[model samples]
Target: MKKRTVADRGADGSERPRHCADGMPNTTMEVHVMHKSIRTPHADTRRRAAGGELIGSQEANGTHAWRGIRYAQAPTGPLRWRAPQPASAWDGVFHALAHGPMAPQYAGLLAPVPAKLYGRIVGDEDCLSLNIFAPAWASDAVPAGVQRRPVMVWIHGGGNAVGTAASYDAARNYAAHDGMVVVTVNYRLGVLGWFRHPALHEADSGTAEERSGNFGTLDLIAALRWVRDNIAAFGGDPGCVTIFGESAGGQNVLTLLASPLAAGLFQRAIAQSPVAETFSVHEATERNDLPLESQRTSAREVVARLWTAAGKAPDVDAADQALHATPATDLATWLRSLKPEELLSVFKPGSVGICLSPRPVRDGVVLPLDPLPEVFRHGAWNRVPVIIGSNRDEYRTFLADKPEHVRLLFGKLPLLRDRAEYITESNFYSQAWRSLHVEEPADAMLAGGHADVWTYRFDWDEAPAVPFVRPDILLGAAHGMEMAFAFRDTAGELDIFGINTSSNRAGRRAVAQAMGDAWTSFARVGVPRLSGDAQWQRRTHGMAAETLLIDSPAGGGLRMAGVRQDIASLKASLRLSPQVSSGESRCRIYARVFLWSPLFAGLGSEQEYAELGREFGCAQPASVFRQLTEV
Candidate 1:
């Protein structure tokens, strides 16, 4: 099988870990407690919302914070792999302070997300919770006919396998400063988030939704439902909500955009660096390797491999056998009984150091057949306004350690920031790799409706990137770097999510100001402003694409250039070129072939010099090209 080049990080190459550790018995009861502190608010008796009473905390800044409030029933014990159930209302005041435990971490579970490249997150199964950041005046009680500020629900990125709502705090910046209600969420991770089994069908109540393998996605939907029902008290307008996220979280937002289950949950969305990969149930589940094996793909078979490697967690290992040999009844029982840690080591990285276990399944019931095809093919449930974009350099760090051929295309050796050495990724340059990301969807959304979509390329490259140590390799705005600017407040300057930036960049603060205004503005109204001065044009297809190239120079001053190029038409032309009859005129071939050619990215300004008629040694079988086109 051919290897895939880009995803959210290779797990961003979407969102893994696998395998037993020596000596320790990794199991359920023995599950480790996450240590990240989720602060409970100082006691506030007067104001409380539905879901019983929530004890709130008052920040020094006068912002009200409510952390670690459950939004769904725990997916533990018999509830494992089931669709999330609404959180049972609590009796006493639910202490809204400390963050709840995040979903367990494993190769199957990913964390530090795309933007969160550093930080230790403690994992737990009881992790479906949300934190609320509301202004002092925004109480849960709102008079009928009165309206509150718009709401923004944040989803954190970790390759899809691992990340926690506790990983970020948007209260001080987004809510307190912007005067909007902010909600950060914690969803299931790794296998707990996405998994499917044929035998699992009999376990459900026969409801299509019950047997779904999209728990993480369901968790997000549930949070939105909670926001819609209860946000007014928090001083938020439930009818006007925007969902935004970076990396895997961004991909989730995109998923919500295409999901029938998520229709009407939010009126607007912003997806930053969304991983463009999706999986089918069989593709997600099927694998054959190791001590206990099935010839083909099966959830039980996948689990049995974990059992054999980890020596059981004792539940399923206690069973007679795995694979086809295990009875359906026994399999279901074994599945429910398997410990969290027991399942932890079942996944590991391949020879090239990429973990492959965590991904959402496209079960026709909950998730559509394919997100890209469905939304691009006019299959969206809510035609909401979308702000979608990618950074100028998305996959540099991932390429830092890959083979030479891989590096040649995606890498900028040491310091050479601009002018990438060669087009290594079949095309060349990491930014070029991301062009398809924003291009495909933005064009589709525009074709669907005007002003319904906006696309951008994040170009802020001033920060440290280690930055003092190695600015050269960091190149132009790398993946997940724009997040701090987008979610932060201007006063503090420093951000909670640790990304490297310094005052040295002349107008760094200006960059943050631009992003903050854009994000908060979009949340308040449908339209977003990249900078105070620049006008953001809606992206459209065939028509010259007006992409807002957001960049701030060394001295300062937000440079928002509305570059015009018909990326949609260019991509469309590339898709059509291979079909033209052979022996065609050079002008026709020159027009399409060279642009998409593996050499295009490396060509730089020499595009006019490149000749398509010349025989190039590097060419895939014609059938492969056609197959890829079909896909």
Candidate 2:
């Protein structure tokens, strides 16, 4: 190792010991410089792991963090769609200072790029890695009768298409103050992570996991296995692991719960703003001849696009014929040889930054054939303690981008056109999200005889007032708003909307403390406990089901109520609300809520929309609104 002397200059230009080459302060120089001031020196941040020796960095918060620790081999060359393999042991010390590359994806808000490279692919195919953060004393010798710290593994959310482990700073708060080991992981995204085709399966020699096309799911499972085998070196209890995430990460949390292969990998789980939806084998592979942009995610459609782009076929018909005539081995080789950017260019991203790709597939191997709800209802899932929730205004953040509701000024600031209509529509869709993500899943787990389920609704919507821009109206308790509080992220890691302000800092800090306490408490034990009299209760059956409301003190604070919603009740309330002006407006809201939302997308059809309109005194057919919205 290269040796260097580093010091801090005092106000008088005198040298002060700050860091040494061995990762410890120069105690002799410090004692002579300041005779009265002294402190215990921190241990060197070097540790041994199964893979090799790792050297991490110490943070300002007195925590040790290791980034870009390879848990699995890079999925490149012929291993593109195969299950992840464990990383081979190395010979020398690995300096884990920076994060590994994210999965290949288009540059967006989650993974931003330079202005010149906007909308371009900006990641790598060799992206399977994990990060770890622990307290400074984690590597020290444990005293007698003391137990290891609980582990919390984080999975980032980017529609399961775009995100990186480096985007978050886990050691700043969660690990430094909460006395727990935190882990952030990166898995394959978009088509590379979850593609299903017969040719690729033939290349892999017919392995069940490879044929399932759930490579991302398998990547997460491999990470958990690595934690179980190696987390003890970081002073973590592998048996007390908790899997948590928001948005698509939350969706993956639910997927792991229902996966038989993920059994015993974790003892607790927290899913925030999660959508419980999965694609079937047919939806993942079969060609959908629909004109909508979403139908192009299927493997058959992707192959046709690649074929035409590669000049191997003239049109769709010729592409289909060539695909049929090509040998399975040749097709697999051609797919492996294509550049990552070329494969990513075939699919377009939605306004919300999510690519049109199938999520977790129900392939009957890694995941069950039945839907997640059915699997939980039948007690076929890994029954662990769970906390599930959604935001109150889940759809406002999404709807703010729609041209009809809000118009952008200077291509940045937002101006709401109709506050009443925007709020009404946001309510309908947000309630639907809550019902599907929280209520139904909680009810299913209860039915499966697992009563250790807690639920919450994030309702903190106190954005400071700004002229011309109404963040309070545009982003009121919207999706992913609770993550900053959940992780105690005072540095604004998850605050992409710039909702934080000086006026709300105190309230935000209070809420963050309460939430961080509750989460750490849950990881320590199975139940969640707060500091004050606000005791979070479990979900019960029947009409008396209760949900904890998480909010700031200025916004009614944290409380519990017996509030529940379902599709039937939501439609009924929409029909009665005075804000719904006309049949056309009501149909527009219905189209967005039922057809575009991930929870009900594939299940809802035009026939159901028309039937709903007729039953509620609206004479407009569903096609009229569908054509207008192009949904």
Candidate 3:
């Protein structure tokens, strides 16, 4: 196969050449090009780092960006399903212009493509690369008495299934305005990233790390190792590195906290809208038999599906028998021989190309055998300065897409079908998300003796109230809304729905500035100091724990609030809340909170659901609960 170079094409797969407007090779050491006009430049875009000699580009923000720098070799062919290996040093200048291919996944919002390719499988297996954004002075000679800037590594979220580093421009505001070094990484996703079966393990002679069924987690550790070794070349302090991510990325942040291999790799951690859930080795490898186990796609299920599809068996039972009879080595080779698309086809796709697959396995090697909250409670995790938070209306973004709750006007804009139902469901699920992802973890960390833990609740929901769209009700402080504020994304890179309108720009900018300052301040020092008299406090134990409420000035601005509710309290309140009009409605909410949401797996039981229903004088039938359980 031919080698890929940055000059070959753009991320959209269009062929483009790297050159200056003067029709000459743009190989100057330190040339600044502003609005297509060259100007005086003091820093060299070229750097000799641990990876190799490479040439980056000077961005409009006065930040230098090095794109598509390989941190690990391609996890393809024989290297598939194995721990990442470091990339070998190259000989000549590498054109770090465009981003490398993302991990193979169905096209969606996380990895957007043209409409014609919306749900099609895109990207490649050779996708273990990272992008760097540093202040202009980073690549230049160090000043006489200046200290190295703090490093912040960002991990994108796509359910650990579909996301790319290229979608984000780290230099836009974080690296440029905050005076910090930023790095974004791409790792394997979906089944390719996390899968475990006895056959593959029997065929391999590798160590525990390779057989952990947590290849994506290992990829992140590899990226951190690369940062530790090479970040200093970009004038960043490796010792002050911070890892921050949202959603699935946030879950990864929590996973790293529990991972013994990740100890000392980072000094500070931030997990935004993270799910504090990790699967057991049995959950990752076998089919779900118990009611507590999540109905996620498992290794055995995938093999059976593939077997039936290939005419090797007529049904899942037959497929399982055939798979059991086959030799382990032969099974391993057959699995590796399948194409990426063929392997991905076995699982059903969600509304936007999301595949509900198992990931971040608790293999007892990379991660502790206990659950993340339990790990924290036992004081066994990497106890670092941590900042954890969640959006106030996280579930609205997800529920807005469901036809039962919302309907699209002209098949484009969203209109809530039942306002009361929508609000009630959104409130319950959103708070449930916070309980699992934010509150429980914070409380557990405090129990585990980690004192420097700051918590926040993003309450900014100033989206414009345009015609045919009820932004306030539909997407008020929804999941991922806080990301733009954190990154100060004035370019609207994340505003896919046009939420950041002209009318809301001022309020958005204000919130963004506040959030950006707090984030960078946390990265610099352990404490997150806000502007003026408003102080962000660390979370303490019990009900009086303080939480910083992040919002626009019109929405109360940034201030400290008391502790929030947990899952048990939320459940108890729901049973008494006037919003639940009927037993069926209450049962539906219970099913979604306990069964449908992956974060709440093993936290609910059928008996509990039945008991809750009995409180309403009409318990839902067993069939109704069973159908929801399967979902």
Candidate 4:
């Protein structure tokens, strides 16, 4: 095998070295397209003439690129809540010049703001799209043995509400420098994608699949299916695909790993700050306003009272019926009204009593079983390799947004500016402890196969860009900060999730260099290497798991300095009495239900069911039985 640079062409035909009349090099380049058009069934799409590139294939100059490709169709209008269907082929060449739109944004989740104001576009309905960057010259002519490359698919994170694949540009940075292909994908977000109603099943009763309501999630499945079927055309090994994402995206990745629908679509997976827990079907029905025995009851009630003045339960299938006629705008307003309360309703409700509690639902058709339970009981995609970890200050970001909420809890505010103090003042000490429980799912997934599990914490925080005290208040590498370095867009301004150090060129380069190498190496093979030459250690059982910490000093290998036993204790206490509050109840139920279902199935442990009982405020045996049977 011959070593290649980003610009070099090997067996793949090379483009002619051309210059303008004035002999100036071209700043813009054309990306190649792979067609599944019936007219060109076995078509060859070499971009030698225009520099079209395929994903995951190595090229000369060590640069690789894959332009626009279809992962899933936009699920708008009649398609809303429907499973994604394969996209149709085109006749003339289609240019994947820019990213497609993001999912519809509501008040919470992925609500996109102005790019100028926030550096990100708000969510839209037409967000289904795909983009890839690979070695610039990877071509069909590249021999088969030399073309064996690992593939990485990225799912953007925005709390499962906001964010798009278009938010980041991996083409110029990670793909070019790492010598591997990178793919970014978009999926449905917020109510437009996740809303559920019982009418879905009866309206389309011929198909049992019509009942489940995880549209955004199924969009991911469609994307993976596209990669499995079409990635090979771009010199990618369909068998070597890896799915990775952050936050909600991370949650989605793990959900797919556990979902049977996603089995065998990819060989490895990574989830950052994963939302490992989801609502049981019963919980979803309750939150979505469905009656304990019927979704139609609640949906009809809302439609009749809210949408129709007559307040009548018209036929469910009637297009103008109250149940089906509720507008998307109205739905978004309803969801937004519930946003602020989510913090209290779901995770860490402090003073507030009740809050909005919309979460992922475990419908038997889509989710099958709860992810945590599935993982704990050795029930997910057992054969794939995985890398799972969380940011150092995952929850503090939430704190930064609501200082008053903290003041409401702790009485007087603590004057803390240093990263350490902030972590303490923000109640991070308690939060981080409970968070360690997240490792159960990853551990179970790795235990069943030849899996390499790597964990990490990002500690770097750039100097504050604006006029704010604690210029570097230092959330200590808060959630999603690592994304800037990973995608190598530290210099480029983005719509939202802006560049961390927008002005510092050298620091961005170094971090980007390190991150790109690590990610691409993992995609190429199974292990991730931090730098071009540095060897990353594979994680093993019964050892202090080595984590590559991205901090002021760019280095790998760091462990949590503080003890996590406090969190364990807190978790245990919460399990015994989850109904103390909504946040406590939600977190405790999520942890126990997810923990037992995945790794210790049929354990019938008292702690697990006891936690569930507490979540529903089941004061008596009859109430507990009622809740379980109703679900």
Tell me the whole-model lDDT of each prediction, alpha carbons only: 0.60, 0.78, 0.79, 0.50
Tell me the lDDT of model 2 at 9: 58
**Model 1: per-residue lDDT, tens digit, 478-556?**
6667776786534333333234445544455667767878877777656786645577777755545466666665523
Q: For residue 359, give model 3's deviation from the true position in Å.
A: 0.5
**What lDDT is reached at residue 490 by model 1?**
40
TM-score of each: 0.74, 0.90, 0.90, 0.66
Those runs of model 1 whose alpha carbons end farther than 4 Å from true positions after fitting are 1-40, 43-46, 107-122, 138-145, 288-301, 310-322, 349-355, 401-429, 465-468, 489-502, 553-631
Candidate 2 structure quality by residue, lDDT tens digits, 462-580: 88778768888889998878888898765555677788888888888888878988888787766788978888988888646388888888888889877798778877776677888
User: On lDDT, who's better, 1 or 2?
Assistant: 2
For model 4, the stretches where C-alpha displacement exceeds 4 angstroms are 1-68, 107-123, 138-148, 287-359, 380-382, 405-422, 425-430, 433-437, 446-451, 462-468, 490-510, 531-541, 545-548, 554-566, 570-631
| Candidate 2: Cα lDDT at 304 | 83
- Model 3 alpha-carbon drift over 4 Å, by segment: 1-43, 138-146, 290-294, 543-545, 622-631
Error of 4 at 188 (Å): 1.3
Ordered list by TM-score, greatest first? 3, 2, 1, 4
